[model samples]
Target chain A: MKRFLVVGSRDLTEYVNGKYVPLVVEELRAKGHDVTLFLIENGVIAARDGSKAGKVLNGLSDKGARVYAEDVSCRARGVQTLASGISFSNLDFLADSIAEGFDNIVWY
Target chain B: MGKTEPPGSKKKKTQKVAIILSTGSYQREAPTTVLRLAEKLLERDIEVNVFAFEEAVTLTNRDQIEHNEPPSLRKVLGDRHVYVGKFVDQLLRVGLHGAKMDWVTCVLCAQERGVENHQIGGSIVGTLGDLWKFVRGADHVIAIPTYR
Candidate 1:
């Protein structure tokens, strides 16, 4: 399995319901790769608790996929109540993932 | 360092790409990567589907655009039939879809952008079901978000 840093977006309504954020994360883990999902902008909401995605988000953690959220994005978007594995980080984390050899495949 | 295949050794690889943007005209690095990736897949004859949602719907709007480098907007959208209504038909025309997905949040986005009644053609904008369908079979999905 290839190293993937899947990207999520900010729109959680209409086209972007919460279920998919974890669906992608779960698939990556099922494939047996070291995976981590980065929530940027709207993606940050996936990290929140008590949502349908929180179950999947925590499942990703169980399967060893680290969930990361952008701190700046969180603050900018005014997101609170993050999920278990979801935590804040920097946008440079994305760059670092790339430098560490994660081919990015984002979902917004 | 691993057993990675050389440049164009891929023929039947599966890919799922979701692109979210504020507007189709925001020619940033994300779109650049996405457009280039779509082009590469088409060139390699690998299966590629770019789920365009939010402002990404603008990706198919080939009118009055300006990001034409190796990623020619006219060519990229034209090649994948990103022009909207014909996206799937065009993919089939090029013999490139085992499964192609459309993730357009056209209504929500349209309203946000005051386009709730925008009659732009070349695309179909509808429901979350479509987004889930795309996510279901996606090998990999990416989002380029639009602030709207």
Candidate 2:
């Protein structure tokens, strides 16, 4: 199975790019690829407990795709509690993922 | 005695600056800042090249202006060098046109946006390779991301 990492930079419901990420991840996973969703910048909202995007991301996580929020981004935005299933990560992970040869890296 | 520099030893070099703008027209803030910067650079005799992409391409649509005013791109960019990526066909009412401005749109971006033969007169259809030529030849490149 191909490995995929999708990076987002805006709240999932705030822009077209944000809203499209989960859909793209689901599609890739449905096609039998392993997918990981990483939210950064304002996109950290996707991991907030009560946000609309957070719920959607939780559903995607339950379906098998892994979801994460950048730790620095969350701290800056005061996002203390992440939505269920979303984990905190860092840029180091992103660099390592690239080095580990992810088949596809999508940034939005 | 301290070291004495020779006369005419260090001639002033003309700075070549390039700006890539990705915000659309309506936002106003980012584009205004870009034009102001370009104007400031021109005042200091710096060579400026501007490339507009995504929604920023709307700046080339002359008819979309709400009203004419100072600091507006049309007023400020007069006789200046400007370019827009062709993917703009999706949002533009018309393409760049004017006697004083030099404007070109990326051909591939335009075709991808289904803008074949549809842009207003005066804008040249170019390619990304051409854009890269400017970027590579320039001394400094500035990118203004989309804000809205």
Best by TM-score: 2
Number of colliding residue pairs in each model: 18, 1
Which parts of model 2 are misplaced by more than 4 Å?
B1-127, B130-148
Supply candidate 2's per-residue lDDT for A54.
Answer: 85
In model 1, which regions exceed 4 Å deviation?
A12-18, A50-52, B1-148
- Which residue pairs of candidate 2 clash? B24-B55
Please provide, for model 1 over B1-148, each residue's C-alpha lDDT reduced to its tens digit, 9 standing for 90 to 100. 0122122222334444444444454443354444434444444434444555556555444343233345456564553322332342354345434333333545676566554444344345666666667667655454555543
Q: What's the residue-level lDDT of B79 in candidate 1?
A: 35
Docking class of 2: incorrect
What are the per-model DockQ values? 0.09, 0.02
Candidate 2: TM-score? 0.46
**lDDT per residue, candidate 2, A65-99, as tens digits?**
88888777788789988888788876555444543
- Report lDDT (CA) for all predictions: 0.53, 0.61
